[model samples]
Target chain A: MSELTDFLNSSGLANLDWRAAVMVAVGLLFIFLAISRDMEPYELLPIGLGVIIANLPLTGMTIFSDNLSGHQESGIFGIVFHYGLSFWNLLPPIIFLGIGAMTDFSPVIANPRTLLLGGAAQLGIFVAFWGALATGLFDIEEAATIGIIGGADGPTTIFLSARLAPEMLGITAVIAYSYMASVAFIQPPLMKLLTTENERRIVMTPPREVSRLEKLLLPPMAMILIILVVPRSAPLISMLMIGNLFRESGVVPRLANAASNELVNIATIFLMITVGTQLSADRVFDTDTIVILGLGLVAFACGTVGGLVLAKLMNLVLKEKMNPLIGSAGVSAVPMAARISHHVGQQANPRTFLLGHAMGPNVAGVIGSAVVAGVFISLLPGG
Target chain B: MTFDQDLVNQGLTLTAIGIGTAFGILIVMMLLIQLMGWLVRIPARRAARARMAADAAAAESRDKALAAVAAVSALMKSAGPLESDAAVPAKAGTRKGAEG
Candidate 1:
């Protein structure tokens, strides 16, 4: 009878706390959203599973060490969090490399003017940084981490949050990704509200056909220029450009394929899951989290507005007028943000093809945000 | 104060620096792209010029060969008509002799 009672008490059911119950429900919501809605399924599914595993009471799976009691066990997720994120910060660079290998720089090269629009889009990062600081709930370091969510690039948000505020890494990264997915919904209203019917109807001329030699030279040139300016950004940008070089060289399909496919897949799985496991109930259920969410949205909206404003401004001076809708793609949600620009553009002018035009700023946004992130790293004392 | 004046000041400063640096680098990258375009054009332009020269040389030889063939055909055409005329006269002379 005593043995049976002991076994019942020792089970996960009896040991579960109210906070753990709440976190599990949160995890289930993410899982449900992923499976049914098909929203970032690859990222959310693993993260949701990790969240459930971490929150469960009396599980040694996520515990690393308790100095007070001298308890030590390296869980699989814990080890990944320590080595992959905390110590070395290797995951984001690998993801960047994969992004580089798969990316096409022709649109960007054909229209270097779009690079400024990409730079303009990063205004939201500082906007949110200001907002976070104004709230006084977070210091500059934490505020900077929150500010980066405005960039809308998952790997960059993850990299910055992991570097500066390891504690906020989980929630900040999740928020950044969620907002990136929601950009399709969030950007259209802003794009329409900001632009007139005439502006939306603007059709851009097709970009020039780029040469093979030009494509091959871009990676190394960009790598040198960017890294020379911001050495702290070397790891991310170098990997990104090298991956691009492999693709353009026409001599290394196998390397490019592995970087874009196998290497990236493994890193994303480990990185996303590790980030999810760090989000405890204590971290999730807070006034600050609510505030951060509001700031993140503001940041994204401001970023879209910033890009639109620049594009509109550019049209005033330039002879070959640009479609203002393409400016919103500078937020760097990859093709999704660019697609939003194209979609909104079609609503106004059915014949106008904006996807190629929008992609110029879209890829530029990736480099723009990384450069800003490096600035943040250089100026601030990280947590 | 609801907000820290010092933190806000720092934020303002950082915001300026961040925006300035990002734009500066992008502009530099833009100029670099233009410079690379010019540099990349040099080799391509040179190759195009070299190809044009080689084509001119080939065309020169082909035109000379065509002229030689035309001259040869013209000479053969002129000689054949004169020879046929003389042979016809000789045949007439033989006919007269036979008749006599």
Candidate 2:
């Protein structure tokens, strides 16, 4: 009888706490959303599984402890977290490489004015930065990290967080990805609210074909120029341009294919899971976490508004009218944000095809966010 | 390294610098892309036109060759004797020779 009682006490069910239970529930919810709602299944499914695995009692899947000598011993997930995320800071740049290989520069090159929309969308990052500081709840570094969630680029957010504020890494990464997945839901309403029916229905001229030489020259020129200005962004910018050069060079199909497909897939699995392990309930269930979440939502909304407003302002001055709807895609969520812009525009006018135009700002937002993050890293209290 | 002191002032400074630099860098990138596009456009158009002209010339030559082959085949078909008639005469000559 005593043996039975001891066994019962040692079981996972016996040791389960409210925090772990809640985390498990959250993980389950993410899984459900990924499977049924089809929200970032590649990212959320792994993250959800990681959450469940990390939260389970005595699993020892992810362990972090320090010895009397103050030497830290880390488990599998912790090793991934340390080496991939913090120590070498490898995963995000690799992900950027994949993104670069996959991206089509023609849309952005066809319409350079839309790049400003991408820049404008970064207004949300600053707005959130200010809001986080005003709360007096977070330090400047944490606030900057939190604010990057508005960028809607998961890799950029992780990159900035790893450099500036490693403590809030998991939550900010999760929030950035959550918002990115929910772009279909979050962007349309804000886009409609910000723009009028006529503006949403507006159709711009078709983009001219970007020359192969321009495509080949672009990655190198842009990389050299931007890095010259912000040397701190060299790591991310250089990798991104190199990957793009692989794609545009037309001589290395094998390397481009490998970077875009296998390399990205492997990195994403490790990155998402490691990020998920950071969401232990004790770390997440705090007033500061709640504040960060709220501020993140505001940041995304402000970014959407910023892009839309800037597009409207540009239309007042420019000869060729612009579709304000495409501006909302400037938040760096890739084709998803751009697709949402196209969908909203199509509803207003079946003839209006804004996908190409939206893609300009969409990709530009990636660069803009990386630049903003670089600026924060350079100018903030800590280098 | 500590961010706890004068956080708002630092935040405002960051906001100003970050926004200003982002816009400036991006605007410059935009202009560079435009300039590059313009410089490359002439050569690109020339290459495209040359390719199109070469394709058209090749297609025209191919069509002419095909037409000539068809005309020659038709002329040969019209001028040539029927195989049955020619074979009948040969067969007849063979039978006559055999009978002789």
Candidate 3:
């Protein structure tokens, strides 16, 4: 009876805390959303698995430290989290490379005006920054880290959080990715609220055919110009352009294929799992995390509003009309935000095809967010 | 820095700077893209002209080849029966000579 009691005490069920159980439930919910709703399966599924594994009472699947000897040891997930996310800062840039390889720049090249919309969308980051500062819940650095969640870019959010406020990395990354996945639900209502029905129905001319030479010139030119202007943005922008160059050069199909498919897949797994391990109950259940979540949503909404307002402002001076709906895609959630724009436009008018137009701002939003991150890093007090 | 003071001072300043820099950088990017487009078009135009010339030359050579093949066929057709008739008579004469 004594041996049995000891065994029971050592069991996971005996040691499981309420917080850990709550986190497990949250993880299961994420898994359900990934499998059933088919929303961001690659991100959420691994995160869910990581959460469950990390929370299991005595499994030692994450970080373990000995306080007396001042010795530290990390499990596999913790090592991945440290190397890929915290220490080496490798995963985000690699993810950017994959994004660049997968992207089609023609849509952006077709209409350069949409780049302004992307710039406008970054207004949310500042709004959130100020908002977070006002709350007194976060310091300036933490506020900056949280504000990037408005950019709707998981990698940029992670990069900024890891740099400016490593303490908030887990919640910020999770919130950024969650919002990205929920773009389908979040963006449409905001887009509709912001734009008039007439603006939504407005159709612009089809984009002209971009020359192959133009495509070939774009990546390198962009790389040189951006890196020259904002030196801090070099790592992310440079990797992105390199991947895009491989795709456009037409000389290296194998490399392009590997970057887009295999490399991205491997990186995503490591990134998502590592992110999940960071969501230990002690970190995630804090009042500040809740505030950050609320602030992130507000920031996302502000970005959408900013883009729409800018588009409308642009239309005031322009002869050719623009559909303001595509402006909502100016958040850097990639094709998801663009697709929402397309879907919303189609509802307004079945004939409207806003995908190509939205893609211009969508891709530009990636650049815009990276620029914002650079600005935060360069301008912050301690930075 | 304290929250209220920082929000009022540095926050506002950062806002202005951030927005200004973003718009400025993006505008510059837009101009650079335009410049690149214009620069690339010069070479593209030249390449286009060169391609057109090469295509015309190729067509001309192809037409010449076709014409030459037609002329050869015509010559072959016109000369074929006479050559065969001459050969037939020479063969008959040789056979008669051999018999005698």
Model 3 root mean square deviation, Cα atoms: 8.6
Give lDDT tens digits, candidate 3, residues B26-79. 888788777767786798789999999999999999999999999998998887
* Candidate order (TM-score): 1, 2, 3
Chain B TM-score of all predictions, in order?
Answer: 0.59, 0.53, 0.51
Give the Cα error of residue A312 in candidate 3, in Å: 0.6
DockQ-superior candidate, 1 or 2: 1
In model 1 chain A, where is the ten-residue run with the lowest total lDDT?
Answer: A63-72
What is the per-residue lDDT of model 3 for residues A108-160, given as tens digits with 9 covering 90 to 100?
A: 78788899999999988988898898888888889889899998999899888
Tens digits of per-residue lDDT for model 2, A1-383: 99999999999999899999999999999999999999999889989988888888877657755455645556788878888887778999999999999999899899888999999999999889888887888777888999999999999999999988887898999999998998887888889888899998898889998878889999999899889988888778888999999999999999999999999999999999988888888888899888888899998999999999999999999988999999999998988999999999999999999999999999899999999888888887664
Tens-digit per-residue lDDT, B50-84, candidate 1: 99999999999999999999999899887675656
User: What digit string (tens of lDDT, one per residue) describes model 1 on residues A1-383?
Assistant: 99999999999999898988998988888889889988788778888887898888777776665356665666888778877887788999999999999999999888888998999999889889988988878999899999999998888888888899988989998898888878988999999999999999998898878888889999999999889998878878999999999999989999999999999999989998888898788888899999999999999999999999999999999999999999999999998999999999999999889999899889988998998888888888772
What TM-score describes the B chain of model 3? 0.51
> TM-score for model 3?
0.85
How much lDDT does each candidate structure score? 0.89, 0.89, 0.86
Could you tell me the lDDT of residue A344 within candidate 1?
Answer: 95
TM-score of 2: 0.86
What pairs collide in candidate 2? none
